[model samples]
Every structure is written in C-alpha cells, then in structure tokens.
Target: MQPIGWVLLILAIILIIIIIKNFQIVPQSHAYVIERLGAYKTTWSTGLHLKIPFIERIAKRVSLKEQVVDFPPQPVITRDNVTMQIDTVVYFYITDPKLYAYGVENPIAAIENLTATTLRNIIGDLELDNTLTSRDVINTKIQVILDEATDAWGIKVKRVELKNILPPREIQAAMEKQMKAERERRAKILDAEGDKRSQILVSEGLKESAILKADAIKESKIREAQGEAEAIMTVQKAYADSLKMLNEASPTDKVIALKSLEAFEKAADGRATKIIIPSEIQSMATLAATLKEMVSDKNIDISPKSEQQAQTTETNS
Candidate 1:
C-alpha cells in the first residue's frame, strides 16, 4: 500500500528470481560454460552448481557424455580417377566446457565439415581397391588428424569410421566380375597342379615296378643258367666214367661172343609171344662167316663150341 513497501516487495521478488536462476542443477555427464561479460569464465559439472547471476551468464551448455555425429556423404575421386560417395561417423566428447564454448564457434559443425574434407582428401590419394580394403587404416588416420585439429576446441575425438563406401554401379559390377574370375582361375590352377603331381607319382611308381620286374627276370635267367650248367657237368662226368670202365677191361673173343648172344636173348625176351630155335643154330653159315672175319688174327678162335655143348646135353638126356 505504501510506496516504500511496494519498492521493497519488487526487490524481494527480483532477488528470489535471481537466486533461483543462479543455482543450476546439471544432470550427470553434462557441463555448462559460464561467461562473464561475454568472455571465458568458469565451467560447471553435474549436480548442484552455482554461478554469478547478474554478471555471469551461461554462454553455452555442452554435454560431457560421448556423442556420435553421422556426417553426410561426400564425393571423392580416387587416384584411378573413379568417383565414389563415402559417409562417415565420429564419436567425441566435450572434455573442457570452457574451451568447448569459447575456443570455437559451432564446434559440432566445424568437426563435421573438417571430417568430410579430411576423408575426401585421404581417400583421394588411394585407389578404389585400397579404399574398399584399407578402411581401418583410413579411419585411424582420420581420427588422429581430427583429434589433433579439434584438441583446441576441447573435443576429444574417440573414433572415426567410414560408415559406407559406394562406388559407381559399373565399378561394382566390374569388381564382382573380377573377383569371380580370380576365384575360378585359382581353382583351375590348383586342379592342374594336383593333376601334375598325381601323374608324376604314378610315373614314378610304374618306373619302380618295371625296375623290379627286370630284376626278377635277370635273377630267373641266372638261376636257369646255373641249373643247366650243373646238368651238363653231370652228363659229361657220366660219359667219362662209362668210357673209363670200357677202356679198363679186355676180354677174350669167345667171352665177348657169349656176352653178345646173352644180350640178344635178353633183348628178345619181351618181343613176341613165342620163338623157336634149332639146336646148333649158332653154326649157321651167316653167323659162322661173321665170327670167322672178326677173329682172323692168329691168337683168336672161331670154333663152334655152342654145337658141342648141345650134343653133350642131348647125350646126358
């Protein structure tokens, strides 16, 4: 109702509002950057925090939590002059709130644009095949470069990744065809190699088998020759023994004649069923002539003693 009381009431209301605004409750994994008169001042962390209300204002509030930023695809030309579209993602966190707010204007946009430029530059220096295969190496290089660049902005680049790499349709088809042909060529080479090895082994085995067969034949021929030699030696020894026995003995003519007659009788024993011989048959003219010629010498005798033997036998009977 009074003017003084009204002024006091307005001041109390202003003071309460200031107090409420001064005390800031930041959530976990978050930070606030306080600026005094539009200049770098201090940093606030999670939980209950206080700031100079009238003199200092929160210039920028940044999350200390890890964050992911997916950058838009950028077109890059490889060393082979092939154009490709590549997309990337980056993981970062605000380590120093004061520096994050004051060190750079629009820190997130700066990071994204810098990442796109660096990726394009790096990939441009490589061939299409290298780009597709060496993604990890590229990612690490990009992360290191970005980490160094963004260090002043208080942004810790945790990782850099190439989300997708899309070559032209013709390039994709060409790569597929090349891969298929490579696999087929390798398969054919392996098959040929296996066949060559198999043939070599088979040839070696056949060669060894032929050698063994030849050795067997040689051994058999040697044994046969040895046996034949032994048989010939035996035959020669028998002939020599028989000749020696014949040369060692000499008999009278009568005894030789009697032995020949006995040999004739023994030879005819199994010839026919029956035979008839007259007494004194040995004195026949043909037999007498043959014996007289063989014993023409003075010391030989050709008398027919066989006829006298027969006559004696008859008288006794």
Candidate 2:
C-alpha cells in the first residue's frame, strides 16, 4: 500500500471508532442533556442516540426517577421568640433535563438552601406550640413553595416533610411536666367518680336492706294477727256448736228443772255478790231444806244409862 492510502485508512478506522463511541443508549427513568458547540441544544430521552464527535457533547445526565434529600437541622425562630432546630426531607424529580443541566450550579445544595429558607419563613409565623403540632401544615406549605420555586430548575417537588423539630431542653422539660400534671388531674377525677359511684351503690344497698327488714316485720305482725283472729273464731264456733246441740236435745220439764237447779248450785258455789233464785226452783229448794233438817235430828244417839232406864220403865208399864 502507498503511504497516503495507509494514512487515509488509519484515519477512517479512527473515525469509525469515534462514531461507535459516540453512540449513546439512554436507560429508563434517565435523561441526557446535549450541548452543541458549548450551547444548549436538546435533551435525549430513554433510547439509542447519536452525537457528533467534536460538535455535540453530553452536558449532564439527569435521573428522571423520584429522589429524596435529607437536609441538616437548621436553626429557626418561632413567632413566640422560641428558637428551635428543624430538619427536613424533600422528594423531587427532574422534569426538564435541559433546565436541570444549566439552571443551577449545584442543584442539591440549592434545594437544601431553599428548603431551609422556606422552613424558616413558615416557622417564623407559628408559635412554639403550633410549630410542634402543625407538622402537616408546615409540610404542605413548604412543599407548595418549593414546588413553585424549583419549577425553573426542572425539579418537581413531590413532597416536603419536617423530619424532626427539637426545642430547647428547658421547654421540653416544661412540656413533660405539664403533660404529667394533666394526666394526674384526669386520674384524680376518675378516682373521685369511682368513689362517688361506690358510695351510691352502698347507700342503695342499705336502703334496700332497710326496706326488706320493714317488710318482713310487717308481714310477721300481719301473720300473728291473723292467727289470733283465727283462734278466736275457732273457739266461738265450738261454743256455738255446743249451744246448738243442747237446744236440739228436746229435754222434759223435770230434766229442765234439774238442769236449772244444777246451774243455780254452780252459781251459789261462785263468789258472786248476789244470787237470784228462779221461781220454779224455789219449791225444790224448800223441800231440800226440810229433808236436810230431818236427817240432822236422826243422826243423834242416847247415852247408855238413859237408854237402860227407858227400857225398865217400859217393862213396869
């Protein structure tokens, strides 16, 4: 081969090598920023792409996937003049590769600084108590502001989270003390309610017991009175039955007179102040007195000597 042909063959081989090397394959969820002669040209998406060896260059390779950045704690002052340290996390993704390549010198650092600034501004409007409790509000406000501000830089802010908020040690101690006191107060109220309920239960039990006792006593007295009344009724019924049987017998006059005499005798035996004799038994009483006189005279006996004299006189006559 001639020397000139050899040089031209070597040049062609080098050009083929350069062209092969310049062929780019953009992967998924990635973008390539192309610069033509040190000027922004176009962005390359996920595909096979070609670039001029000397005129076109890849300025930047930006990831289109979601990304997260955790910023360091930054000092912030609340509306109550309370100082605190707050850290944050930002979720973002590149929306425009061209802007991302040329918009900012350091995108991560710019985002961090922007996050810190927005956080301070938002926190400065809230008091310490609101700052501690309004995490979602703060996150939303920061996200909205960051999304708007970072739109020019090709960063789409998806979410902003307040990772941590640290207050002064003395303020933390005071909060803990206040929480403990509140818990204790609630516990005391519960105890008082429980005690009140117990006392009410005890009083109700006593009241029920007293009522039962009174009812029992009333029932016992009622039973005793009923028994007494039944006994009296039984005795009266027996007496009435006896009187009815006597009336049904149909006694003769003599038997009736004798029964009257017996009743009069029973009345005489008692310690009565006065006794009234019936006219029908008066004759019977007189006869009974005469018989009693004769019996008394006959019971007398003569002496032995008087009896012998009486017998001698009778023989002489």
Candidate 2 lDDT trough over 10 residues, lowest sum: 308-317
Off by over 4 Å in 1: 1-3, 178-317
Model 2: how far residue 44 lies from native, Å: 0.5
lDDT for model 2: 0.83
lDDT of 1 by residue, 1-317 (tens): 99999999999999999898788898888888788888877777778977877789888778888999998898989999999999999999988887887788889899989998898889889998899999999999999999999999988999998999999999999989999999999999999999999999999999999999999999999999999999999999998997577557776656555666555345344433222333454555664455345334212432333544531111110
**What digit string (tens of lDDT, one per residue) describes model 2 on residues 227-268?**
999999999999899868878987777677666656645644
How well does each candidate superpose onto the true structure, as a TM-score? Answer: 0.55, 0.58
Model 1 whole-model lDDT (C-alpha atoms): 0.79
Using TM-score as the measure, the top candidate is 2
Candidate 1 clashing pairs?
Answer: none
